[model samples]
Target: MGAAVGAIVIGASAGALDALSVILPALPEGFSLPVIVVVHIPPDKRSVLAELFQAKCRVPVREAEDKEPIVGGTVYFAPPDYHLLVEADKHLSLSSDEPVLFSRPSIDVLFESAADAYGPALIAIVLTGANHDGAKGMRAVVDAGGSGIVQSPEGAFATAMPEAAIAMCPTASVLSLSAIAAYLQEV
Candidate 1:
């Protein structure tokens, strides 16, 4: 039942709470893979996602800090208004780069960088969202020989993101939100 993956990356926008609430809590205690998340959010509003999820999750959950080393068995959500990236050495980095797909903390930036850093040892999951931000990132993961999973468009609260990812990488596994939670737990 081991997923040979070194790290996991997830991206979402609209309806992200429902998806994350399901997925994060199901990770068994001491699960070893590091999870990095990007959820489109307001540029000015404070992000409480880390605090919100930490209470509900078994694993350590926090906001990604610039230059921090990425740790296994933890979940990190990108801070609002910044792009989160994985350095080749596997350290977490923050960028004030221009937003992608009109969203700061763009999913594409995180996915693309993580794809390069972890390559075949990575898994990228695209969940519910309202835009196409994650499509290019999913393709990058696939091209880098990493695994890609997309939430089924039909079951997603906002289908555009999942549909776009599926269209971009037709070979990715398409599953329901609950199924996605189960899948992550098994990894």
Candidate 2:
């Protein structure tokens, strides 16, 4: 079954991820959609992203583990060196597949899988990034009946990723980071 209210999947590369700290805290407490963030991390080391996000995020934040069930009100980050996928049952699946767009925790892989799992119930968000990794998967989300959002290229630090997403899917909502957070609150 498709997600009933739609889920938001945030995709980004390193350079374009700075504003998340500010945007994350502004979301309302009653908002219950699960947010899965796919940020590119270096493969050679363990990621402190969960810990880092824990400081600013009002919701619980943790690194994704294999077979863990996805729950609302928690933030889940893809562990380094693995591709994170959303199962039809809404559990986490981690894979060591080859990198796409030179990223193991590829945003595209996560978005594509989530699109398949959630169908029209998914909402894909493309954030600031130096690479175009998310474009293809954002398209997949749209193709699968999910809504797609891209941060306004003018507001993004690295416009390539969001630009690519919007270029590929003309219907995506383009907003600033703060606005994106506000929009998520309504979800």
Candidate 3:
């Protein structure tokens, strides 16, 4: 059998929505793994990313709620002002804890927690972003034997986050937006 991916965590900032619009729509309806995403948004603004993706993607999508059980074949996005975390038991949690690197729904928090919870079954994707929020978390995912995929800086609208992650995990697979979508289909 191919690698059994239990969960996929994606982190993005800056031009993330445009990137996600391209990526999310490409996942097939039968995708069986859970996808959790953290994209930087202004704390005061409402997030409709889940709804936006849900409309275009085949898989069901929703804003992650605190204490919800993590389920397969669904896409979950962190709420605007809270940090999303994955528990060891595969449950979702939300924290109003102080922002990390000025992002409330910090990508690092979700990626690190998911790495701890899913270990090698996890696949972490660091996409286009203007900041380094997901770099350390991508390293954590790699340390836990999970796969790390970074959007090639040439394709990213903002290169800092992907570049940082690639710097930390030099062996990570680098792909373009459409290639990432295709990779998810394979996973």
Candidate 4:
């Protein structure tokens, strides 16, 4: 809450169903702010997240594309097997970089890059996941003076991600999924 957020970035794994539940009603049609998401999937599997969320989300949703301009009122999910990054110019970039923590579309990669681009005007959220991939990323967001939110571990389907994020950034808000969704709606 240090600055008015112009963008939001969220990361999760082992959380497709949980993400769907929290995201569907969180964004109203035409809501401002570009939302970027990364939910890990096997590299060989084609990502259907954009299609899945686009059907249910009120705001426009699509998979992030290389060199694409980040648009307000839209949600862009990281494509599988690629690391999604936000350029200084606020364009989306896809890299076939080495995996971090065994994940190609690393939450850390996106969050850190987005923090560099948006700085204090970014909001980063870490949802349910099985690994510690998002912890360092959430720390980066907070260190950049952006707001960071972590799902309450008690309420998460897989608690490690949120717990690690919380450990990395103690000042981050810890909220239930419902609370997180409500906060998004009110933002």
lDDT of 4: 0.90
How would you encode candidate 2's per-residue C-alpha lDDT over 1-187 as one tens digit per residue? 2357556788878564486775667666665878898988889989998898888777888899999998987788999999999998889899998998899999999999999998888888888888898899999999988889898999788888888999999988899888888877766
Cα error, residue 64 of model 2, in Å, equals 0.4
Task: List model 4 lDDT by residue over 1-187, tens digit each.
Answer: 7468889999999875566557655788779989999999999999888887887778888988899999999899899999999999999999998999999899999999999999999999999999999899989999989999998999888999999999999999999888888898887
Where does the lowest 10-residue lDDT sum fall in candidate 3? 1-10
lDDT of 2: 0.85
RMSD of 3: 1.1
For model 3 the TM-score comes to 0.97
Q: For candidate 1, write residues 1-187 as lDDT tens digits.
A: 1347999999999999998888999998999999999999998989999999999999999999999999999999999999999999999999998888899999999999999999888999999999999899989998998999999988889999999999999989999888988988887
TM-score of 4: 0.97
Clashes in predicted model 2: 0
lDDT (Cα atoms) of all candidates against the true structure: 0.93, 0.85, 0.93, 0.90
Cα RMSD (Å) per model? 1.3, 2.0, 1.1, 1.0
Which residue pairs in candidate 4 collide? none
What's model 1's TM-score? 0.97
TM-score of each: 0.97, 0.94, 0.97, 0.97
